[model samples]
Target: MSQQVQAVIAPGENEPVRVETIIVPDPGPGEAVVRIQACGVCHTDLHYKQGGISDAYPFLLGHEAAGVVESVGDGVTDVAPGDFVILNWRAVCGQCRACLRGRPWYCFDTHNARQRMTLASTGQELTPALGIGAFAEKTLVAAGQCTKVDPEVSPAVAGLLGCGVMAGIGAAINTGQVGRGDSVAVIGCGGVGDAAIVGSRLAGASKIVAVDIDDRKLETAKSMGATHTVNSKETDPVEAIRSLTGGFGADVVIDAVGRPQTYRQAFYARDLAGTVVLVGVPTPDMKLELPLLDVFGRGGSLKSAWYGDCLPSRDFPMLVDLHQQGRLDLGAFVTETIGLGDIEQAFGRMHGGDVLRSVVVF
Candidate 1:
């Protein structure tokens, strides 16, 4: 039987998304249908509407989401109906080379739903954003994509682990390897950057500096665990970071903005033999042309964090538990909550730096 779901669909480039009735199929083998409770309005969704991610028009736009499994198809085992889960884009194929080598985080093959969700009226195939479109009442995903977690926390908060939150925290804990007494610097105090700051604090970093052009976001960063804040608009961040780190620089500098300028600042703002982690999503036109000697002179790893190098099965539940225990501030990241129809306005708010995350609550 087909399920009728209210989905946010971007029919063409730069077009406003419409909430339309979409036909969701019964789950196929290894697939499960989740009744979405909440989905965050991330920048990626806006990018999809702008034709930045792909030319696949009539795209079902959403990814960061959490919900309860409504049904399961044949051969599904990891999740069953009634289980609460956070949807993950990277459903690791354990038999892949990266997984075989014991690094499932870099799984070469990830899984999505076998069938496509389409427009009910036109029967037009709608490409799902990041393979998990959860702006609807229900969406289909691979069984492996649903990572079960505690149901005590609101889905509005738990769903965040599906994306940006995971990216920020994982960037610090996984890519940066921030440790006790380490000095860490995060550029761009958006949701991801703030999450990095929180992660740094969680990892026991002694000094966490947050750099941003906006004073308000910097202040929020302070609340999230940034020991110091730099208004990058009025200051040279690289120099400010060095001053804060005793004229050396932070042991780790993260470019959460993912621009050439911010990346350059992060590149030059780290202490010798320190790491520079890029977790921000950059546009294709944006290019970095730093000196070759600088890359070698740094003497530390230059890494790009993909979804914060997170293993959904390992990180989501643990983080959810942390949130439940009040160890992590997942709730703090949610600046505002709205219905699915508010996504387009939420995109504007995101662009205007008005909110950290505008979650769509079903």
Candidate 2:
């Protein structure tokens, strides 16, 4: 039997999100229904509402989530009912070319529940944010999307590993490959950038400089293990970063803001042959122009991090265990907890830069 549950949804472009009852059907083969414990409000959710992601109206908007596996359908063997798990967007298919090459994290074919969630009032099928609509009390997803972890970890903290937190950490460790004693500079001191700082510290980077336009965020970045701070709004960040790195520049510079200006700053702010990682999302119409000579002269990698290029199965459990062992401060990223009804208010608070994340808790 189908069950009705309240969920946060954007009815149309630029519309405010509201709690509406939606129909969740029983899981089919390879699917699972989760009883959501917590879900984080992410910028991607805002993008979905603004139609930045697509013109898919009536979007079910939440992805950074953790929950208990309430039930599983036929062919689901990895997770059972009552298991604590973090929901991921990428459920890799082993047959894909990337998976065939042993890089399942880059699997071209990720999985989502084949069933459709419908709005009870109009029977309109809703598009789930990131294919994992998790704003509701219960959500259906592919069994492969659920990565079981320590049930002892707080759901709010564990939920973060579902998206932004994992992206930042992976941006450093998996993509940028920041090593021990390497100097790293992260542009943008938001939750993702701060996570990059945490990852850099964990990797034993001797100098981690955090760059942000907001002084408050810079201070918080310090708490997240930033060894140096740069107020990009007040000073030329490239010069500041270079000055901090003994005029040679950092080994790795990550642009968490994802703008032309920031990318250019990241371009010139690194030492010769130093890697530059672009982790921040860019608008579709956004374009970049760099001097060809400069690109050749830089002589290093310029890479974009898609969800930090993470493998949910390998990364989620290790990160949760690290947090449980008092090494990773996952709790610091959660600034406040709100109910599903408070999503609009939380969206308003997102730009304030003080709140790292406003999580929706059931």
Candidate 1 on 10-36: residue-level lDDT in tens? 999999999999999999999999999
Candidate 1: residue 304 Cα off by (Å): 0.7
Candidate 2 lDDT tens digits, 1-362: 78899999999999888999999999999999999999999999999999999998999999999999999999999999999999999999999999999999889999899998999999999999998999999999999999999899999999999999999999999999999999999999898999999999999999999999899999999999999999988999999999999998999999999999999999999999999999999999999999999999879899988889999989999999999999999999999999989999898899566589999999
Model 2 pairs whose backbones collide: none
Q: 297, model 2: CA deviation in Å?
A: 1.7
Q: Residue 5 in model 1: shift from native, Å?
A: 1.4
Worst 10 residues of 1 by lDDT: 293-302
